[model samples]
Target: MVNKPQKTKLSSVISLSHSESTRIFEKKSDLEVWSAFDKGDEMAFNYIYRGFTPIMFSFGIQITNNVDLVKDCIQNIFIDLRRKRGALSEVISIKSYLLKILQRELFRSIKKESIHSIQNIELPESAFLIEVSHETKVIQLESETEINTQLKMALNQLTARQRQAIVLLYEEGMSYREIAEVLEFNEVKSARKLVYRAIESLKQILKN
Candidate 1:
């Protein structure tokens, strides 16, 4: 039951425009759906949860190892949202909006438990822990068990903020502006720097 990142970008300089175009359309549609859901559309609300719960779950786990707590926080947020329906503001990106809300809620829960976050970043938790899929093609050369262990160890070494940056930028495919909104960074430049530094740090650590 290893759930990891999915639908990674296929390298193709030729189709870059088409890919970006498709992405933009999808983002626009998601925003529209969210707007409808905000206005008391039950079907639209369910649609959002069905599509994003898994991704949100993955993101939540990076913040804390308590799977049950993460699940509760997710459901709780939606329950609160449902209660506050029709008052919700227009959102540019549903994923970013949801992540921002979820992050705030998760941080509150983590604080009650008195957990220490990595690098003392704002609202930080311990090293962002992750579970890699054994099926990842890049690690196919190594035995599954060995590769999985290595991947987890490497991820565990990263600060919480770095891991959050990696998950948002890569796994969720968020733009820097969207990431800044979700992570509450002061500027988009800070989000970009965080992602770049995280990648460089991962490359160095994983090469060992």
Candidate 2:
């Protein structure tokens, strides 16, 4: 289990590990991409789509626990983003904006699914991890699989928001400012606070 200080230190590591010098994409900023897209640059739109889709996919799968549903929701999200581009407000960080949209789309799908089902449908924690690990274990051993399963169970014990925080802060390697923007926090400090709280909860949950 990662302690508060250790997790806080890990957060810094997570934030800094990604090299700012590396060119992950040619485009500089979302606003720049948006401008090019507005000018009818299909390639610019494609670039944005490619950059954001994986994050959206992971987030969607986590919240909804339905692969097809996640695909549908993400498609719809891009459609909506395109449709609302003319009225798109100033966003501090494009990553955060995309995350917020993905979360909204995921929740909407969940609500719809709930209404359609007469009985409550409970999705296990780290459902996306299950999908990814399935193929990995096929090439590996049973003991490793068991350990991975237990780790996923540990992750499942976290609250929904905490899970989200941990994923964004650790797995996705987003900065506190970016997470703050995604979560609609007034400041980055609040975002850090959320992550710290989530980490503490996860440590306690995993320790037991």
Candidate 3:
């Protein structure tokens, strides 16, 4: 039998030319892009996904130490964008709008975790093995321990719902609208009030 060379697939090697790449960004204003996206413009949505995913990823990492959780939060936010597309409207800025969505999603995830966190067992001692000088170590340990103690005191100062709202909005970066949706509050104002009251309580707690 004669030997024959195997053909490799070339389809995957296709790439965007420089002009094509430039055209994508130069094509539309933010409002126009999102308005089209609202009506099911897949291209617009794809552009939005590409532009905002990294920002969301950064915010997620800052709030949650778990990379997997960050990935899951971002994926869920994009899924939400698709799911809510029909109701989207012209906004002041696409970047801000996308960030708000990401913020809301991350907060929702954090609130859920906080609710379930009590069930978590203590981590092994090996998790705290980083080294420093004895004085620095003592200061670091005392700082973290004091923060936890103060946080608990602050939590006790607020009503349960207020505490949850504060944690989700301030700690987790969720917006008032998202907090309303998650908590079944009547409006964003209500969510804002919940957080506001909680902050006041926390200030009082810290002062004492």
Candidate 4:
């Protein structure tokens, strides 16, 4: 059986990294840091937690407006990581892996909360929200104002899954295979199709 770290120990492990360790791990690749972490290196764990927390929280908040719930879910995943580090699999992109875990954990927590609360909760299928910013590098248009208005409209027309696929592809810089893994698509082709459909829809909308 895999031994999980106790809460107190986990907290200490996550919180107590030295400056030298941070400097050392900062120069290491994700795989190296992750390998060290899996081997029970607290410094690597701290490095990961500190590095990824902002982006993870940003991704989580886009899925749902519940700030407290997003924070809680982020906290829980790190705890789970520390608890199950020994059983963790090899990871290529730590960002993609953590985002994938966060997405799953957010949905799972939302479902559980919905069951116990009297108020109806927004399901994962419809909950994803994104604001297409002025500096968006993926979609280029002839005019700035035209870009913002039309792009926002086009994005709004997309299903939650498609919008998410686009963000993961463009905004997060994930490969099709990574997207498939994160979105739970059975194959990379599914991820490709999703992004293709989404882009085609955007083009058609913008052209009109």
**Per-residue lDDT over 1-208 for candidate 4, one digit per residue giving the tens place of the 0 to 100 score:** 1134555676687677657578989888878889989988888888888888998998888888899998888888887787787888998778888988898888777878774663443335554555666677456445578667767877878888888888888888889998998887889999999999988987888788
Q: Model 1: what TM-score?
A: 0.69
Q: State candidate 4's TM-score.
A: 0.84
lDDT of 3 at 35: 81
lDDT of candidates 1 onward, in order: 0.71, 0.63, 0.57, 0.80
TM-score (C-alpha, index-matched) for candidate 2:
0.65
**Top TM-score model:** 4
lDDT of each residue in 1-208, candidate 2, tens digit only = 2246643542343243123322433646767766665564545556667667787887777766578888876766666566565666765466778888777666656767574753443334544332225444322434576766766676666666666666677667788998887766898899888878866875786677
lDDT winner, 2 or 3: 2
Q: Report the lDDT tens digits of candidate 3 across residue range 105-163.
A: 65666667775654433222222122223234212344565675665555655664664
Q: How large is the C-alpha RMSD of every model relative to the true structure?
A: 11.1, 13.2, 11.5, 4.0
If the candidates were sorted by their lDDT against the true structure, best first, what order would they fall in?
4, 1, 2, 3
lDDT of 1 by residue, 16-50 (tens): 45444444344557768777778865556656665
lDDT of predicted model 1: 0.71
After superposition, candidate 2 runs with Cα above 4 Å error: 1-27, 116-155, 205-208
lDDT (Cα, 0-100) at 132 in candidate 4: 63
| TM-score of every candidate | 0.69, 0.65, 0.45, 0.84
Score candidate 3 by TM-score against the native.
0.45
